[model samples]
Target: MLLTQADIDGAVGDLSGVMRRTPMIASRTLSERIGCDVWLKCENLQRTGSFKPRGAYLRISRLTPEERVRGVVAASAGNHAQGVAWSATQLGITARVYMPTGAALPKIAATKAYGAEVVLEGTTVDEALVAARRYAEETGAVLIHPFDHLDIVAGQATVGVEILEQLPDVDAIVVPLGGGGLLAGILAAVKPRRPDVTVVGVQAAEAAAWPRSLAQGHPIAVTAMNTIADGIAVARPGDIPFAHVSRFVDAVVTVNEESLSTALLLMLERAKLVVEPAGVAGVAAIMSGAVDLSGRVCVVASGGNIDPLLLSHVSTHGLTAAGRFLTVSATVSDRPGGLIALLELLRDLGTNVVDVVHSRVANGLELDEVAVTVSVETRGPEHQREVCGALSEAGFLRE
Candidate 1:
């Protein structure tokens, strides 16, 4: 069924007390960088750490009493699993979530913590989906698709309603696109009201499918999908959402892995918001110039359910990308004070040493030589260059 403005209005009314009207905060840093008044729709702070519940709850709530009694099953890498689980618990129904074997540990734990039976199967979400479907067929359970139904689209449209109410002057909206439910919903709700406002969708370059699907004039499956943005790493576009995208979305873009990491770090460090890689795709698009950033722009911070270990790795990668961290290996004399002297040089150069390792008896080391690997924090690229220059001038040959 095609979703209309009236359907979205009904959804907004139905979801009044069920969902949180997440904050829309102004971002001065992003505004200055993009030369526009930037606002962040902070769905990352929503219940279950994503906007998934907005659609999940609305879909499950509309289920007949018999369907609810049979319980619900869903497949997700993280966010959607939590949404379905939380919604099922709220409605006094049983929930079973199928997750990929390699899904983030924290997400799996959180899904189970939310009172759902967690099943770990396959290596990707598509694979887990197979298991979920088989279980639904065998047990007569209702399968709740992540983003392919009319009700789901209408539920997600409420986010668009909130955006317009919160920022009526918003000229552009950038959102992370996976199966296109969120983008489709926003377009259905916002386009009719403000035809001049632009709606853009972003995807990870490594896992993008919409561009190819649009070119083919139908949903096309991506053969190989790999990216750090697992939450949005969908291989196929949902038919229901693709219809709305083709009709209303202004443009779609992709951001590289480096930009995704940098954007996540920027939100964490500069915006003081903990956002996942997928959640920050809109921000990445803006920072990388993938989207037109004119007039009052709103970028959706879609989710924040990130694993701590992955966060640590992304943080280090972000630091490297921003030129705030450096690693150098140099050969030095095997003398006792050789390492100390090199460290003193770094200290004199005002570089903060993060880690250091020294070794001898290596392929490039002479009998009286040792290789010292130093990891240091610098102010920026220029500061790193200065430290390297000082080390080279002090007779520490970089290896």
Candidate 2:
């Protein structure tokens, strides 16, 4: 059933002491950029490093003593796994979390640390979910789905209640859409209190299913779900959350890979916040100008559980997108002084050379020519252009 205000209120009361009331802080940088009074609901700092516990704790808490004795089984990429594990540990219930083989190592470790028996299974969440279902059926364990449940949605809706309480004059709210539990919950809570407030939902462009689902008037599956934002990489929207999204969410948009990376980096550099790629969907949407940045907008910073290796890769990509880093290849004379001369010119132009590879055996190179691929740190787009112009003027042919 679609959640009502009473359900959300009950969830807020139920979640007290169980969940931290995550802060809503003003972001001056985002506010200036978006031309609105921007605020961030910092759910990333919530217990278990995400908002998942809000729903997970509530869902497990509602289970009967007999059901708890049967134990709980769940499949998740990361956040939900930790949530369920932590919640079940507190409730003294056994939780078996099936995670994809490729799931982030940190997430898997954290889940296990929280007292869950973690089973590393298939390559994707959906595939791992199959294994989890089999385990549940065989063991008579209750399957705690990541989303798509009345109680879970009600639990997630408590975030909206907190948001409304924190930012009473909030004109708009932007949320990251995965299975739509968070979005559905927020909508159920806020829409009833203030129906005029605009609620926008964002998804990774590569894995988005909402646009298509809304178009076809039913939940439709995407062909592929490969994305850096693995947290929101659901192939199909959950039927339960879809019902709420259709009724309440104002707009659903997708952010490309580059935009997602840039947003993540921006949050780290400007806000000193380590937001996961999926968690920064609202920021990505606002920064990319995909969402309407009207007055007093609050974007939910959903989670902060990101793999360090992935963060490094995304940071470099974000630097590239922002024109802070550049890679250029050029052909110069094969003489020793040729490479030195190119380096001198770059140094004179204030370009910091990060790495350089010089080779004469590259395909299409002339007998007297060598190919030099240089990766440099630049100030911005203008510095990159200046570096390229200076190289071209020095008779280096860019490749």
Q: Give all candidates' CA lDDT scores.
A: 0.93, 0.93
Off by over 4 Å in 2: none
Q: Please write out the lDDT profile of model 2 over residues 301-335, one tens digit for every residue.
A: 99999999999999999999989999988888998
TM-score of 2: 0.98
Q: What TM-score does model 1 achieve against the real structure?
A: 0.97
In angstroms, how far off is 291's CA in candidate 2? 1.4
- Displacement of the residue 376 alpha carbon in candidate 2, Å: 0.7
